[model samples]
Target: MIGMYDDVVLSFSESKAEEAGMARSMTAFGRCSDIVGGKSITVELKSVNNRFLDCNSRVPRAYGAVEERIKPYLQSRGVVRGKVDVFVSVIRIDGGETELALDGEYLRRYIELLRQMRDEYGLRDDISVMTVAANRDIFTETESGATEQDTEDIMSVISRAVDTFIAMRIAEGENICRDLCKKLEHLGALVGEIEREEPRMNEAYRARLEAKLRAVLEGRGAGAPDEARIITECAIFADKVAVDEETVRLRSHLDAFGAALSSDDAVGRRLDFLVQEIGREINTIGSKVSDVHMTDTVVEMKSELERIREQVQNLE
Candidate 1:
């Protein structure tokens, strides 16, 4: 959802599960405006998910130095990763003066060139001050002096904007955390189902194998196959198809993911690693299982893990 408050726009996502306060999302926006030191300073910050911190800024040309400070200040405030854009607008409320000086020599040369063009092309002789003034290079504009106080006011507004930005990130992160937790619960349930189905699937496979062996022996008019040989084959089949190790590792990865979501520190990278590990286990199980029901269950688990991975990419 998106909302507007004065000049600031805020967007938040909704989730059905309970909110968790930990973690921070990389997508958010914040804006702040204030009148200070005879100037109206407004700072706006926008960020989106990125693998690394990329900060860019646009400020008044006279205050170009402020641009250099913005990125470092954001880093100091714990903004680790995102594509961040900073926009600043400063309007002087005080009666600040600007000096304009005419370039007499350039003006003379420009008029002379205009006359030459008119004579050469036989164009209308309609040169006037308004027309000549269109060449703004004939005038030099000297802006009022900038001071340290201006930089201070701009940084102050930016500080407030950063505070609001982080707050929004945290709020959105809470929704993400809640959604992730719900998905993790679903995945856990799927894993449990796979575990319960494993024994039955092995039993079914054993029964089919035994029936096939008995049919072959009867067709050849031979005595019944050795019982010990049948038992040994079934044991080998069960061992080959077992998913105990994969499921156990998968559960462990899920627990680590849940714990990372509860941490206050930056866990985006950690969460990504856990998701990859979980995917490896799921794929291993998928490869080992041949039962239709087990295959469908594994597919569902992969889908849920993918959802979690998408959310983790938006974290910082």
Candidate 2:
């Protein structure tokens, strides 16, 4: 679902999601370029992740007070999350909506109050042109403002561009998923390799322990004393630090991760959770084992998972 439009030279940026945990952070820029011709308006949307849709608008300074008018356009989009920004620039097109002058209720109230002021005290009898001009809101230029229909026309094309931007994000998310799945497959294979090595690894440790115990006894002149007791204690220590159970559990976690990737639910947040668990398991293995080569292999597995996780952050 990559965007059909060409990539415009829009400024782009990103934030590390881990720094803002549980928050799906994303930023994108899209301009309609030739969006629509409605009262000569050009609209662009800039979006960033937020817990709620907090849209702000910026228009030509002449239309400062009318910025709120743009909200009615974006409000109907049903965006529940994001700090959305809208930029509208008017190009001074002719045939714009002519504003209507008003003889509003406020004008009548003003005149009534002025009459009361004069009659009550017989003071300040002034009905000058300045008195009328002081109530500026009571009058406005005829046909001199933008129309709702005009804003709507411009928004239609801007919507197209924003939707296109969303599609691009989804397309990138798909690619990220593919690459991460491959990395997970490699990590799964490494877990299998480590599992295969564990038994032989345990045997090597047993032999080393047996030899070292004999050396220690001989140094203290007990080389041939209580062999059974020494072997039993060494076996207990080895079993306590055994990583076979941990490796098996790690494989189960990997399987769960694969299923998550293929699931219909949004997996960005889920993948992040799985990755943190994977890291914890790998760390436990590295800390429990004293073997340099085994620890090195575990580090490699973790490194690959970490790289995959960096991509997962971009998913939604």
Candidate 3:
């Protein structure tokens, strides 16, 4: 089996490690060719990101059973989600006898059409056997029947191609994991910054409220504002701008996201859900905090989260 990397064993080992701790990207290509059972068998695999697993195969018409087996075989190898296309080609190398015959009806019609074109358009009269035979569809090949061994040989080639395909995915996935981890760290720091500024935000709101109330009372010639009423109004303002619950939930979601990144299981869908939850908490925090600095920080957090969401879609 041929692979992109020279050290297939080491590449496979690293792939398994990525499967255990990181994520697999759903885009890669692999091709393998080998001589088996006196036949040259080649298999190619290509995949792209998709919301679900969609497997398609293209093989010789005589080997329809090979197409049926490709999908389940891929799933067995942990290809949970992607649009995967497999191609298989086989050539006999043992000097086997084969029959080729011309399609009489198709050849007749093709010749008739060529003559008609020549007559109608007064075109060149250079059409000959070579020119006519250029249309390959005018001939047919009688292929030998497929046997159990043919299926086995083709499947073996497919397995090797998949090995290299998965290794490429794992390598790309590790890079994605590193980028995601950095973004998550930034998110955690932003959450901490929000928490640190929460108390100061409440105090600022309370002071503003008190000053507004005092101004209104003095304008009405009411001598000094009632201290008790001012305290009650400030308390209400503080409660209205409180984001302790939201920030706490946001922090928890960030932690869950970090844990999911290192999980052994398929975490694409799980990470998607966590991003949604995190967005909800960030929105809540945005609504509660009116400070200019806090608002800008929240916007930056949302921007980072959006990037994370886009990156998560590439994972499987």
Better of 2 and 3 by TM-score: 3
| Clashing pairs in model 3, backbone N/Cα/C closer than 3 A | none
Best by TM-score: 3
Q: Kindly give the number of clashing pairs for every candidate.
A: 0, 5, 0
lDDT of 1: 0.83
Q: Give per-model TM-scores.
A: 0.78, 0.63, 0.82
Residue-by-residue lDDT tens digits, candidate 2, 168-271: 44445445556666788788877877777777777788888888888888899854769788889789877866888788788877877767755544566677
Error of 1 at 314 (Å): 1.5
Clashing pairs in 1: none
TM-score of 1: 0.78
- The lDDT per prediction is 0.83, 0.65, 0.83
Better of 1 and 2 by lDDT: 1
lDDT of 3 by residue, 227-291 (tens): 99889988987898899999889878887887776666778899999999999999989988899
Q: What is the per-residue lDDT of model 1 for residues 1-316, given as tens digits with 9 covering 90 to 100? A: 0111123233433221112336889999988999988888899999999988999898976677788899898887678889999999988879776667888999999999999999999999999989999999998654479777777888889888887888777878777877788788888999999999998988887788778877887899888678898788878877887889898998898888888877867789999999999999999999988899999999999999999899999999
Which scores greater on lDDT, model 2 or model 3?
A: 3
